[model samples]
Target: MDFLELVKKRRSVRAYQNKSIPDRELSKILEAARLAPSGFNAQAYKIIVIKDEKSREKLGELAKQPYISKAPIILAAVNTKLDDKYSPLDIAIALDHIMLAAAELGIGTVFVGAYHNEEIRDFVGAPNTAEMVALMPLGYPADKEIAKKRKEISELISQEKF
Candidate 1:
């Protein structure tokens, strides 16, 4: 599919099937994240792949989103350079790449931003130098319906000045 179509098809999946993503597809998703651009090429981030059911359960509980544990994998995007102001943006871009890649492969994902930071960081064993920025749950989508209402291009774009 074309990039625009792919982008349109990408949605925040909340329900997922009990299925595992193939290694090939998973590799592609991770590769997309790895290739994401960062400010000044400082890719100060790390993606912690969580596949253990117990850990996912704990994370889901901490996030107060039980649906999170339903997915087969949960990717934790971490900013490794806490001192760098752009680290969070870099991590967000990487996560976006992962979401797009997964959508292309017929997989589903959701960007999870609400959660207990310190608890999750400690549970995932992330170093003190790193901070968890976001969590993404990935798997075959159990809910296929997409009902996205977006703003028109005219309403979203502006001329030289606002």
Candidate 2:
């Protein structure tokens, strides 16, 4: 699918099937993130794809987000080796790539931003220099749901002199 279509179809999948995502498809998703552009091409995002049920359970607790433990794979976005000034932006971009890629692969992904940073950082075995940025659960959707509404363009867009 095209980028726009992918974006439109992409949803924060909350439910998932019990099947495992293939290695090649997982690579494709990660490749999308790997190819994503970063500030000055620093490419500072680090992703730890979580497949272990035990780890996912631990991560779910840390994130305190129900979806984290439900999906077959949880892609934890992290950036510790890089400086903090732009870390959030960089990780977010990478996660976006992963989300779109997952859509293309007929997989569902949920981008989760709420969680306990320190607890998740430890659960993922993230290095001291790296910090947990976000949690993305990936799998096939168990059912469909309505998309959340967005603000109107007029309300969100600012004028030149705003």
Q: Pick the candidate with the highest TM-score.
A: 1
Candidate 2 error regions (>4 Å)? 82-84, 114-116
Residue-wise C-alpha lDDT for candidate 1, range 34-118, written one tens digit per residue:
9999999999988999999999999899777899999999998878888899988888899999999999999999999943388
* Candidate 2 C-alpha lDDT tens digits along 17-135: 88899999999999889888777787776788889999888878877776669899998888765555776788888888888889888899988884338778776788767777788
Which stretches of model 1 miss by more than 4 angstroms? 114-116
Looking at model 1, the pairs that clash are none
| Candidate 2 clashing pairs, residues 3+ apart or interchain | 80-129, 80-130
Worst 10 residues of 1 by lDDT: 114-123
For all candidates in order, the CA lDDT equals 0.89, 0.83
Error of 2 at 121 (Å): 0.7
